[model samples]
Target: MCTTADESGMTTLPEISLAKLTADETRGEERQRLETACQEYGFFCLVEHSIPKKQIGQAIEASRQFFALPQSIKERYSHAAQNVYPAVARGYGPLHGEILHPEAHTDPKELFGLGIENEGDRRPFAGATRFPDEASAPGFARSLLALQATVLNKVVPQLGTALADMIGMEQGWFQRHFSPPTLMQRVIRYPARGGKCGKHTDGGFFTLVLQEELPTRSLQVWFRGRWMPVPSLPDSLVVNLGDMFQALSDERFKSTPHQVAHSGLSDRISLPFFIYPDIYTRLTSRQGRHSFGVAEMMLRNMESVAAGNGAGRAREL
Candidate 1:
């Protein structure tokens, strides 16, 4: 039995593992915390989440190794050409000047990217991954790839189901539309500067961030009209839904807006895995629960967002 506040500002997340409940009895109770927190805070820390601490460390180490490479070496895989997978995935993207937050003063940061879908001649959305030669990161690539495979195959599906249930949809409602899909990862290295990441909301369903390490300045989430600091949990990862989740859940879930401030002391490193639905599939509510087709509704929403210039570039590999 946990209690939370509403939009009037008096809410708290239930001290419970909302993800572990499988019975209707517990689900009824869990819904109170989820609905209230989502409506009011738009973000909640997930404790007891099973993401491995060791894997997180490996991912961080891998990012460090890659970013530490000379600019020329890192640029070998840049996102220059388009294959179903490009050899240089945007090739070690630029400083955080234009992209991360388009119209804001962002401290320069370097980023590496990869998309699960449309990579080389492999299967389209099938389990195909293209990493730089192991020689690039030596002993690091295998561990990092293992972690990625685990996260994409195991954690993401569970998170999606939890999200579906949290927003009043039947469990597994979203899992079907996301296979062989476009899952992207961005490994960001935040340099020490007083500048901050501009304000923005994620463009898709949910983002799971494993903070490999953080500078003194932590990432913050915008909830209920205020920026609240989210300090890293010892062994926990951060999870947040995005605009697409908000849309598909019919406003039942809040796709919280968030940003990171520039750190002046130590450099920051964060690995964000962006999980999205297949481009061709639609995301609809449960049968007998909603009126519109999920995909059509989402497409309509996308059109509106694009018309208003709200949608950012699609995360295609």
Candidate 2:
């Protein structure tokens, strides 16, 4: 379980080392505690994951190179008007493209997106990926491909297994549904600003974020009505649940609310890998007598939420 500063300070999320948990020396009690945290918080920091440290370093370096490109060059990878993977996105979002939280301060940040679309599968349901051309971002394709492969092969499967067990399902049950999973990789640059992005929850199944050190704060997760500040944790990834988990788990595991508050002083940068089920896939199982479609529910809530009379947000992922 996570521990907070008891002397009137805010709570900080617990940091777990994957190496220790996976070791034979780990105690059953520790595992149980870790599992409970996943059920309640749905967000945690991972250290000593198997991915090569250089891979993260390369990803960061490559993003800097991509973001430095001239506006005209970056426009080549801009989202197609009809592409819904990332709606309303420009080639690279400029500072303040959208405000996530109007109640708090606004953020001055721009972003670039890479869509992940799998080929060889004709199921209109599978997602797609968009890669920048070689000329525009030399070696970017190679770097990103290597990173994506690691995420698909390592991080995702581990989390999938843990999640299945967390929900009383046999191990690998979740993995089976995602043989060829869908993913989205976004590179965001929060310019030096007085205010930044607002508080909002992600719309996917889960997210794994890796960010570089910055002069200002980058991300914050809302837990039990209080905001927990997430500072830069070098050589680690920040993972959080999305709305899909809330529905699938029968509310056993919460998809916690989180947001990125404005950085009072300097610019910051972050890269988040958003993982979720295919948009076209039906979220409700056929075994049930009658059920609500996940997509339908999400659409309804988004419409209702936007209308200012939000259909109350669901409890779990």
Task: Note each model's CA RMSD in angstroms.
Answer: 5.7, 4.3
Evaluate all candidate structures by whole-model CA lDDT and list the values in order: 0.60, 0.62
Best by TM-score: 2
Model 2 residue runs over 4 Å out of place are 1-7, 20-30, 81-91, 99-107, 117-130, 262-266, 284-317
Worst 10 residues of 1 by lDDT: 308-317
Put down candidate 1 lDDT per residue, 69-188, tens digits, no spaces: 887776665555324332323236656423334445434677776655333435332333445778777645576666778788767776677667776666556666776445667777
TM-score of each: 0.76, 0.79
The stretch of ten residues in a row with the least summed lDDT in candidate 2 is 308-317
| Number of clashes recorded per candidate | 20, 17
Summarize candidate 2's per-residue lDDT along 73-118 as a digit string, tens digits.
6666655532443243223555545545445433467777654545
Q: What stretches of model 1 exceed 4 Å from their correct place?
A: 1-19, 22-28, 85-91, 105-107, 117-130, 213-215, 285-317
TM-score of 2: 0.79
